[model samples]
Target: MTASASQGASSISSSSIKRDASEMNNMVTMTTRLDANATVRGRRRPPLSRRQRGNLSTLLSRRSPFSNETGSLAIGEFEPSAAPSVDGVARSSLRDARILVVGAGGLGCEILKDLAMCDGIFVDIVVMDLDTIDVTNLNRQFLFRSKDVGDSKAAVAAKFINQRCPWMNVVPYHGKIQDKDASFYRQFKVVISGLDNVEARSITSENPIPTLLLPNRWLNGMINNLVEFDDDGDPLPETIIPLIDGGTEGFSGQSRLILPRITSCFECSLDAFAPSAAVPLCTIAETPRIPEHCIAYAYVLQWPREFPDRKLDADSSGDMKWVYERALERAEKFGIGGVTYMLTLGVVKNIIPAVASTNAIVSAVCVNEAMKALSFCSQSLNTYMMYMGSEGIYSHTFVYEQKQNCPVCTTTTHHMSVSSIMTLNSLLQQLCDGEFRLKAPSVTSSMKTLYMRKPVALEKVTRVNLDKPLKDLMTSGEELVVTDPVFPDTSLRLVVKFTDVDE
Candidate 1:
């Protein structure tokens, strides 16, 4: 061999030696752990009986076997007859409980597995996801496999879980969460979401209108929309269900429990979620600094101009390739680097990188909260938990306060004072640009429709109202029911007070 070839062979040999040494160390650690586990197993207490395990009080009273105390049970006995029952009808167990899980992704898969395996109870579950499985999903979405690509994520995940736990019934809904109405949501005692998208979590039919005035996106609009209120401004008991939400990005994640009207809902803590970063058009079109800038340029400027009649579907391989090529060309021209197909897809689709470990941690917390909410075995996370593994393993559980003037939870009517001379278009603009940050909202008075953005015919009729003054539409102190596409089933009651001044 040549001198350089011999040197390369020596380097490979060194690397192989190091790899072998590392493997040996790992084996030693594993063997040590196994030996310790065997010793502990020898002294392990017998498994608790089904009756004792299902009893919340009994489970709580059981002390740890590893404790220095003499006995494992507080009373040193099992009372089968004392097991809790549901009003003398049936046993108080989660086996009969129905749960709805939305988004059969990474966190969803872990949640389903954990819930099915939890306490050996096979709780009936409903899993929903509109997305189809992709090869990319197999890495973290453990329920799917290479062969399962191109199948519905919800269906595949449900099938896997059902096969693994035959007693557990997992029904899959292969459609958008928005497709389901309030009646469908009322069937579940708890709703757990492992969705990555904010809009999907909120189940918004359309994107919130973009505005610089609001820095945060809409909160769990799904709960607000699903919940119904009585005449006294109290939530209908049947409509209120605990929502356990989990989200993960990189090494960080959070799990939050929302109780409609009672505790803070998703929208109550809107400021916590940072809005998607918006790159200035000037930067994208003129001075490209990063790969994202190039991607945006291709998506925002080039895509429409090139394909005027065809919409750019982010999920379409053809469309994504076209955009990627264009972005590559732009990056090359501007001497920019790091423009990959994945990066382009992420930029166009607005996807965050999901970590499996983070998903698992957050989903476990979510399912635990759900159990607590339903079984009353322990106090529910009061009502938020945050996890950060980027620095070190860190977790915090705390209460998220409810907003008094929240547009969704409370019946507090927002007072909007406008000049009589202000045109309907100006009022609409204010609603879009003001603190409310509503997009494409339809306005209705007590008897007539002032303006509507849908039902093509109705929108055409109300188009003329845009130029009409507020005074011409309604009187002072007239209440207007404002509904936005972002919040389909919920309406914001805005009491419009017309004043003579330009204020």
Candidate 2:
């Protein structure tokens, strides 16, 4: 060291020592100490040197298990046995996987990118989304550009990923998810969704397909940590393919690993969501109180009155202005403030606040969970994880109980009794009237097609059955399989019992 530098270091060290004396005095040391009078010796004198020890042990016999000679065993030495190697879930399995992505929008686009970036892993991905590209989606839907505005989002995203990643096999299904049957989804090993629609996700999760479908993605992340064989040689094979679901809203996000029938699924927490407030028809029509009431009045009442045949398009600026004007006038009558165009748009579209950073964070967690599920690299998420990043980052994870009567988890048939004299049309109409809210339902009994909505020939043949008594077509105690366009994923197995209703 230079003379000046050494002197400067010593001065700094002395100053630091002076400042640290008080702090050091207050601290209690945990280290063990020797006696205060312990003396220091330069070096310990060995009782016997190597030459003396060798001479002393010369008379003793060789002690080693192999032989007495130090070099390469004296004569006939036995070699040690080789240790058995441990095997684990291979990345090759992931490379050969068939993955399906539902929704090619914000979260969907990110999922595709994350899955594609899996180094040295090649897999097939099917992208399914019915929606077309919009100018507004450019914010977080990174796959689309300005020129691709009106193109099918699924096609555009699939094309973008294929072009960017030349080796990726991304197939685009430019149609509504409803178009694909449960059988189609069953072809894939994993189905990851980037959808926000509760109904759509529900359908995907519960559809009795063999393919595991994720209803959400994750909000937290870490490096993949997979264990090979444990103390036991051959680990039991995993039977359940987990559904990794995650979502983000503004600064808050979450990801859950759902083992369908085994773990608490999305349906288990369905009851946690507060039911939508019901606006009484009389209040919305006669005594509108707030902006929402006025808006509902314009949507549910005035639209049909103004244009009987035309449908009010929520995406159209002109249609929205009409609703806003009517709502604004109604609000003024009720002395209600805070009714604006943006508010109208939000109310009509049911737009939720979304943040790009939150989506990225949650998407990473979801994708990572997927990797673990595919290769058993690390433990999958216990059940639920939540992330809140607004006021600094915070997260928590917990296990939620699975629902006993979850339709997705259980094979219990849902039974409903209808009047024996009721016509097939009335029976189908009854589904729409009660708690179900089912529309245009089809029915089958013992693999017999009783009614279906498609194909003009089938519709014509079934039209007569709609007019006939339901009891006449099938026995009262028969088991019927019911499927519909509304709840595409839920194929309800209903046991029909005929009875008379007072109404």
Candidate 3:
């Protein structure tokens, strides 16, 4: 049957009253008599039976779940009599689930609102954010206002949900989650990422907790769902993976739900750019460097030198240089514009609110997918990408089959061996500590070793070993170069290149 037809049929079935024509007529008569009489006289009111009282209560107390003043029980507190049959898996899935949101930004605000208002799912939300409301955030973040500036986002968001649905217990954590330990994070059944940095993403992904990483890209967005299994236990395999498609690239957005394990995990969708792929620092504007001119201009124009008390002694001159350098570094790191010498260069445009709104919508799609996963109604199993432009919306869904020799998943039994998993974990820890190094060789023979300080960006290219043969060096795929030198004593820096590898 068509979905709309089936929905209409269900509605009709649910709304069908069990009362017969005589019972309905009696109810109407009673209602008319009650409306006409200022006080009941002639006959005494009939005592209502338990069943009759229940029917009357059901009719009179039926309130919309989204209503603010509704006396309906809060989520997670449904009465046993109202619970669905235990035999139905779909109804059982959402009975009691704890959802932890790690940010109170634009995306977090929208997801919280939707989860609170939308029916069919029972969710207990815990909001965590270290930031307070800023005037700049008022443009796209919906839950905050000018008056809310400097107020805790988590607290404000929680109050917003409580006012809408008092039954919901929206807990707010007004502290940074970066320093939170794994034990502290275990309270959540699922973790949703609404953060804006690679460090936070990596930390959340590595967490043993089931985590959903929703990062917005230039045009398309990515959702990474990481599921960790118990050491000796196996649960039911994921059945329906919905292919998620849609995101605002230029103007509009599109989304599809994909089932993983049954279809493809975010990593299997693309041979190279998996959902866990690290975004380049340039993409997120984390490693912005100030222009030399800006540094020089700041020093020459803004440096205080006229006041006798503020005279530039040797120490003061060094401090001024340090301040100028620090300011330049910050400007570059945050991708902000450098200090301009000319004030009349025209006003710099702010990041568009529409763009931020688009991001929020895209993030909402990820949250929706999580809700579907929790509610046990996922359908599609493929990678879905959406192209939202000023002109129109375009979407594409592709099923990614596991490569027979996939180093990460395929050749090794679909499950990582304990030792291998431990090794990978160690490597990740090293990467996190900034002790590990990633190198990519350049096309030119002179620029062989590119020392990557951080995994997110290609920073400096230094020639460490000039005498080594370029072709004989061991390499992985064209995009990745692995160096395991045979001679331990020899200080030979190996060369690797970043080349695209076919799946």
Candidate 4:
């Protein structure tokens, strides 16, 4: 067969080969025309053009997504565009939807990239993270590079999305969630979490936006969205929306998702992480704690501050020096080590990345599930966990099997009549008061306040230590009394006297 005939046959058989052949024909035609006069003049052959060189490079460098050189699939290789068809309806639901992600860390960046690049469904994304990039996040967090260390993760991620897919909107929030209240939450049709902690997650989950939550509940609960006038003329929705619940637990991280009435509230989900007898000492040592000199801690412990602000110089050399100095000062003031030892040990281990990544993954899962719920497409109320380790990706789902005699979930107490503001104030007052106690098995008493919320009590409360007054054991009120609690050996106790009732 003629060369042209053979080329035509091969091109017709393969679409990619046909495209290449057409381009090659144009190149050959141009070269022949240019060399026509040169050949007549007996001139030397011309050098290869830059365009031809690039074509050669593309042909030679073509690689499969499964290539060992690339640990991950090349962009767009793994994403499925169309959902599985069932009864002529598409199962993949996110089509031309706007999704707002609260953090651009490990999970946010990955989800944004994947959804934006997927072929079948079009997605618009907005990413918000108050954190600037750090060098320590280079491991499992894939969106960043070495040069992006000082840049804002949110902004950098937005720029990346813009460059890769200008069609998608990847907005960034360089500030905290508290900076963006209801107005911010209402802007997006769906909100996704890439947050780091329970506090942030609670804000996104609990925000009462009609667009997200109302529609979500209406759809998921299979209720008609109609308003009804009651006997007293109070208008109410015809149906109450159910909550969505999800959770994830892994060796590196744990996450819980509560969607209004579907699962538990954010507070209710705390039961999964509630202090149990199975919790170990090392795990307890890792929880974030307030410094002993914290005014709140002093108030709770009823002691006066004897040390300056427990700030550390970034240039300090010893791993434990910053902690040791803080601990020693706290020990002197409170007559106990307080959380200084845990803080010091955490510094030594530098588990910030692990915690941060764990948080990031949990946030991502929570956000994705939230979007699913808001889009009226959620499936289950189980907790989803993502385990990233040498053993590979392992996910587990859990459901709250309501106990017949459970104290927290099954109680018959009346719904509190307080407004949202009053409820929050009451919780805060209770926390500050000596009566409604707060404690975390993982954190010292000084850190207990961090975990105080109406939702936390729904989970079993493991009493780490009983409140003991230093005045009871001291011989004289004039002398400073310090002693360690047998329970939380990491903390110290102190008592101070005030003659005036206000003091």
Q: Find the candidate with the highest TM-score and give its number.
A: 1
List model 2 lDDT by residue over 53-104, tens digit each: 5431221222333232232212112222122111112344456778877778
- As for candidate 2, its clashing pairs are 216-245, 216-246, 217-245, 217-246, 225-377, 226-377
What's model 3's TM-score?
0.43
lDDT measured at residue 447 in model 2 versus the true structure, 0 to 100: 50
- Judged by whole-model lDDT over C-alpha atoms, candidate 4 comes out at 0.42
Residues 1-503, candidate 4: write the lDDT tens digits: 99999998887789877789999999999998877766535876676676545331222233334332232211112222232332112223444455666667676676676556544243467777777776556665677888998799999988888787876667677875544443445444444554432211111122211121212221221211122347975434222222222222223554444332223333333343422122222222333133423222222122224434444332234524544664555545544435554444333322233443454455556544544343323333254444554355655656544433221222222111222222222333433232212232222222233222234562224221223232222222232211111111122122223332232
Residue 23 in candidate 2, Cα distance off native in Å: 19
Using lDDT, give the best candidate's number: 1
Q: Please give the CA lDDT of all the candidate structures.
A: 0.75, 0.65, 0.44, 0.42
- How much is 287 displaced in model 3, in angstroms? 19
Instruction: Tell me the deviation in Å of residue 442 in model 1.
Output: 0.4
Ranking by lDDT: 1, 2, 3, 4
In terms of TM-score, which candidate is stronger, 1 or 2?
1
Worst 10 residues of 4 by lDDT: 200-209
State TM-scores per candidate.
0.75, 0.61, 0.43, 0.42
* Residue-level error in angstroms, candidate 3, position 115: 0.6
